[model samples]
Target chain A: MGGATFKGGVHPDYRKELTASLAITAMPAPAKVVIPLQQHIGAPCEALVQVGDTVKLGQKIGESKGFVSAPVHASVSGTVVAIGPYNHPLGRKVEAITIESDGQDTWHEDIKPHGSLESLSPEEIKAIIREAGLVGMGGATFPAHVKLAPPPEKPIDTVIINGAECEPYLTADHRLMLEKPNELVFGLKIMLKALGASVGIIGIENNKPDALRVMRQAVEGEANISVVALPTKYPQGAEKMLIYATTRRKVPSGGLPMDVGVVNHNVGTAVAMCEALHKGKPLVERVVTVTGEGVARPANLMVRIGTLVSEVLKACGGLKETTRKLIIGGPMMGLAQTSADIPVIKGTSGILALTEENVDLSEPSTCIKCAKCVGACPVNLVPTFIAQAAEHELIQRAEKLHAADCIECGCCSFICPSRIPLTQWIRLAKADILERRRQQQK
Target chain B: MQVLYAVAALGGIGILFGVLLALVARFFAVQSDPRVEAVREVLPGANCGACGYAGCTNFAEAVVGGEAKIDGCIPGGSETAKEIAALLGQEAIETVPLVATVFCIGDNRMAKDLFVYDGIQDCAVAMKYANGFKACTYGCLGLGNCVRACPFEAITIGPGGLPVVDKEKCNGCGLCAKACPRNIIQILPKGTAGHLVLCASHDRGKSVTLACEVGCMACKACVKACPQEAITMQDNLAVIDLEKCDDCGECVAACKPGTIHPRRNLPVAAPRPQDQVAV
Candidate 1:
């Protein structure tokens, strides 16, 4: 790449400085952890452990019968106190297993380290990743194993680790790169061997120069791996955008990255893979950036999965009284949390508590045909057209306009001069289009 | 002598230009099917775009091109369909007209709100707040999202803080149904008389009782009362199969919460005269 990164992307204020320099500190596991059965985008797991059953840490508590799904493990060695519905981060009640910590955090008998990465076969690495229930730890929460397993015809030769951390106020991926660069690179090498890809590249935004430098040094002698500094832009870390930025491969419309012989994973997912393979650790924890104007202490903490967001916020000095919005991820694309009682799942990267000063709750007016949203759409969608079509229930027309291709980057909503919820309406249309497609397939 | 010269020059130039213009117009003339003209002449040209085509002319072209049906226009009704069918040497197709109906029975008196929603008056905008202010998440927010969406001005926010659809004015375009954030509006086949469940809330019986008095409790009184087995319980909500519902009105009497009602304003008058169809 030359000067062009990707067409039609917005550059929001990167409020990443709030916790970019903070070291990832381990947050003490709370007394209770409510892990929802479903963490990834695939099927929701069936609770394997019953209420009152004592479980050790790293024990597979939820099992999914579907091949596309990943299993869930206990984050703490404790008794399963409840095995019913609990508040999920995505704003719904999902089946969850709550464990009251016995204060031991003891490992299960089954948790054994896989042999060295170089010694293990590709199939073994895939099995290890699958057993660890590793997902893209990027907010997408797609099962990582499924991503690694491309079809026979589509031969993948490049693996990109997305360290862009493009969303504002998110420093989880940044800190991971800074703290554990070598481990990430090792994980990337493992991914390369698994996919038989000739090259592995780590893509970090220019905003995180230290992370870029550290990651670059980590991969100094590695033959097949290197680091690339991407232009700091919103949605630069999106799968298609990152692939295009690093490999100059434009993922075709309605196609996956694998279609273009490429695969991408997040920096945090790479580190998690290293932990799963080297230390035989299951994905029980992740780095979460707890920051915003409404937080008393902005911090980057290694939070255990299933820990309630309320507990994480408490560890970060609790929320300020002016907090008006609590989000489970970054400001641009995070799901707005209605309550802190929702537990942090595998996909959560940040918990932003924004005060009224940081939020715009003004009334949305009619669109003025200002083409700012159209220009800002990275997918080259006419957001106003899609929004108007959705408003009138002209879903077929919206689908014909390629509404399903939207990445839901929220640029349209951010760029709208009249403050129309363009992204929100387009999201509604996208869902409808997908639903119609599913029906047609049936 | 001067006038003769001027006249001769002007006439000679006019004759040459007229011949050139006639030849150019003939060379560029589009060859179209005569049936397209015939169909276009028969169409009422309401240009409502309800037939999923652009305008009456476009629909006429599509019909002649075998892309559209003769009975696709709702405003033109059966008489227009018969004319178009006869013109095409095809039998007239029988299709019932449809109208929009509000599925929410929860007015201000029946339902409770969690908080005073002083936010934007639009239902979609209101839903961005904690799934809207309604205690019953499935019940109508009564912000009149459908009223504003109705192109025909058929819907109005009644005194009870619920939308009242004027059946006469509605064109059954299904826009209001889409605009209702809770999805509490429906498009159903129109009739002079009918009986239907007025509520669409899917909340459980206990929660529904706590939230709204008019919501379906899933007691299945209407189900038991329906001789045709038209009503069934789905997600604790009573759904009526319009195909089996013969407007018998027995379910209306069995519904204790007035959740089902007979068409209150009976259409005793004859339907509007069909627009003259040209064959």
Candidate 2:
């Protein structure tokens, strides 16, 4: 299929078929949920409610004074059981609020429709979105309001909705597109109004033609909005790549989508935005894809935010006995969890359980000068050279090679003939570089 | 006659270049302090940057230029300090000998791990993943980053998955302390007879009991029993000030988890019998 795509990216087995056709099934509010205070890529929120305080669904429990942070709401009407460090999907213990469900399914009093989309002004729409705690739900978890409010100098002319569910064994975005195309389009309109942008484009991979068709029909009457089928490739849904695929714009190195007069949001984020604007509902629930050969029943379930992964897995018939690796997202870029006790935050898109057959445990062999990793790097980095430099702790050399630009997409590791963990090495180098920069700044 | 001509021509060119090189060498000669070379010669040539300079040469230059202390060479200790001072016609400030000490005693057998870490074999890298899959967040990761960072081969992973510092080999360069992500390794004065706390866990008493067998629970038993009042509770951990501690062994006895021991009793003081025999 002829469609738009960026430069270099690897094509792994797209095992999205397990949950792509499954309808979004609503998993009941779990008996207990662990809501981490810091779910986005900014300042962590401080807990507003203490233990033993009864909270309602959509009640703001955590908020930060920092401008870059977003508020966190209770996913269920429940009593706050604990407020301390808990396991988060990002593989760290963060301050979280544990709540035992009241099982009332009661909405908060403040949750009410503001008005029609046309009735709300641009400023009001942005305010609504900010208060609703909406973030990029495609696992990046960047606060959405910050993206909407770029500096006055960088004017955004186009907004692209990322529907490229490109990662292997993830179909959360695909199912959302097929089920809620109108809400996705309406959400795009609201964003366009908020940013005062003229054009809206929904970019979907060619593998999901049904979603592409439905989205195309959803935007039939709109003049500025269009649906562009992207060539199926890993990381095509990445902000930079998606901007290029949809608008032929190149976001510069170490730059954001706003640098190229564009902004991108995930399909799940758009639907969440629609709910936030129309229903005044906060971000308390999200669709999580639980699938793999190790899962007894692979499914796409509408999981409550802060629900434990163990409970989510249980709702999907639990993990098989042979399951060895439990990942929080897709296999390529997801964090391999050590236990099933982590909570599902806003960024969690998939919970994948891999059996020992898929979990490769062999020690990484030495690189034999094969440039397969170089060919597969989506950011065009020499993975072997960076990995070697990182291995030797040559932070300066790694920095010189622009290791900070790596998106940590795991393309190099997936395509390496030697099974070298190039991505992990690069990640180390990147972390060291960032730490060095932080020290220098101090 | 032809052989004579060829030899004369080649010899003329060679002599001309030789004279030119000599002239260049004389004209572009660099003026350096003679004591810098002498000081560098006396320094331990490890170039470990323990002196806060680039290497031995740079440190020696700094010393000669009055920009660095005469006792800055940590690995060379007081002997090199005296030599440097003598070369500079100054009195040497006696450098105190120091050795590294790994504080945590929670090894693979004593400390429980929350999960098996199966990724990059580096402490810093592992610390970023779920704050390390260790039950105690402040314990040694046993990934051996310190062992790799030690230029003198002073550190090694012991049989129980804890770093053991060889006091004789360690020169208090503080490289291992800097390389450690958990900040559990510390530089202590050598031959100081004092009681040392082996556990660095700042966890509460209940959590400490659940996580490790030898972790400090901050029970204040040592604080109450210390004769010199050397022990104090800080952030759910008991700290013993060596300057005040007199190797009384009372605090060691009072420690419920057996986390405190006499400094000489640690394996770090002397693990090799052959070195002791020679001494």
Candidate 3:
């Protein structure tokens, strides 16, 4: 079937067959969990529980006064053993609450159903979503309630559920769609009702035909909701690209989706919202895809939010001795971790372990003027030029070239014939330009 | 006869163009202060921008325009300042020469690494990945961004994975200080007869001991042992006020971590001359 697609993307060796068909298995909770306060992109939460205090499952342990932040909950019923700096998946030590599990699976008393979706008001739904600590589970980890509560001037007319797990070696969204399509649709209905949106679309890549079929069947009777197949491409799951592919809308550069009267949420985020609205559950557990050439048993496992990556790897038979790289997300945009001691945060989508054969250890060479990166940039930027400007400390030149417009999809670096690390250079340029702008304002 | 005629025609055109260019040059010349040119000649042409101006030429114009002080040229130090003051018919302000000093002593043998980092060879880029894998977060990454940024080749990565500043070559332009990601390179008054705190790690006693052998543990021994009370503990690190410090080695002998050393013994300071005093 013909599918809607975007411009300028690459097709890497998608090794989804490694775990696409493997059903998501629920792993037992580890003995201890380290939950960081700043999982979402906002103000970090303040710990509400002290050491030696007992907390139940789904208990709000940390919260912040900032409107953009999300609260953290106890993933497992346990005693707070420690509260201090700990390793996070984002590569720095953040203040975290460490709990030693009591081995008893317990739920909080407040985790009761909030009645049917039709009975809840828009304001009430948003409050419930915020109280549940819902965030974009597609690795962006932007608070979901923030998107639902757009300003009065920018009204959202369409809500898009991103089901395109386009990153290589990731099948968590695919498995979630096939197994829990009803919950996904239910969450979308809640979002539409909250935002007063008319149209609801589920954009799934054509690579996962089974997921597309299941999601389509789930949305058959809904008049405003439909599942559309998207061309399997890298970063098609990005909010702007997905909006363009499915609804023919162009989100302006340096603009949010609300600027185009659209709101997008990840499919996993939808499932989490449904659970929060129906079962009064907080975001405590999520599905993490563990797969790579170095993994002994690659599978999709339902994991707790605070679970250490080392424990997850052990459950999956651990990384092989040949593993040279341990990444926290997909291969394209994932962060290469130096140690397995970091805890999984809300933004973690997968744990990828790469062997020597799967990694490229060659030094970056000079650009050959191939212009392939220019063609591969989805945002229409000349990666080569921006990278050169960044290397020479020419911030003004890089800013004039629109370095801040880069979405950091790693397409330019992937398409580079010289392996010039175009994306890293552009990232530096973006940071420098932003810093310069900040200083000028001061 | 034809050759002579061709030469005369070409020579006539050349003389006419030369006269026209001379007249244009005289008419279109822009007026500037003659002292600006003279001041630029006496200033160091490094254009290192430590004076907060664009270059030596801009600074020279600013000085002639009475907008910049004669002591603003840091690389030129007292010599250029005296010359510029003489040209401007003003008293030369006394100035002290400054040099860049690395605060970290956690070399490869003394410091521990948290992990093996094989990414870009830039300290800034490596800092983006878990603060460059150095167990002492305040320690230098030794990636040589400062070496590349130095205009006079005054900095080099020593054998210990630490930056070694050539005090003689470094004009204290502060370019290396700006290039360092950790802010470990400090510009201080040179030729002080006091001890220097060689460690920048502010971690507590336990962490400092675990990370680096030369890290300051903030045990307060140096503070108590200082005869003039020149050292003070600030955020688990020792701060030495060189102005109050005497030439005694009390703090150096009292330091348990051995992070403090004599400034004169580091191959850093030359014998202070009579004219080197800052007024």
The sequence of per-residue lDDT tens digits that candidate 1 reaches over residues A256-370 is 9999899999989999999999899999999999999999999999999999999999998999998978899999999876679999999999999998787786778888998
Residue A408 miss distance in model 3 (angstroms): 1.2
Which window of ten consecutive residues has the lowest lDDT sum in model 1 chain B?
B270-279
Please report how far candidate 1 places residue A251 from its true position, in Å. 1.8
What DockQ does every candidate get? Answer: 0.11, 0.42, 0.32
RMSD of 3: 8.0
The best-first sequence of candidates by DockQ reads: 2, 3, 1
What is the CA-based DockQ of model 1? 0.11
Q: What's the residue-level lDDT of A201 in candidate 3?
A: 94
Candidate 2 C-alpha lDDT tens digits along A136-251: 99999999998999999999999999999889999999999999999999999999999999999999999998998899899999999999999999989888888888888888
Say which candidate scores most in DockQ. 2
lDDT of 1 by residue, B1-279 (tens): 999999999998998999999999899988778888788888888899999999988998888778897788778888888888888877533355678888877776677776544334678877766678778888888788888888789988876678887888987879999888888888877875657777787777788889888788888999999999989998788888877878888988898877887665421212222452110
Give the Å shift of residue A307 in candidate 3. Answer: 1.9
- Listed per candidate, the RMSD to the true structure in angstroms reads 9.3, 7.1, 8.0
Which prediction has more favorable TM-score, 1 or 3? Answer: 3
Per-model TM-score versus the true fold: 0.75, 0.82, 0.82
Candidate 1 reference-contact recovery: 0.08
Alpha carbon lDDT of residue B228, candidate 2?
97
* Cα-based lDDT for every prediction: 0.86, 0.89, 0.90
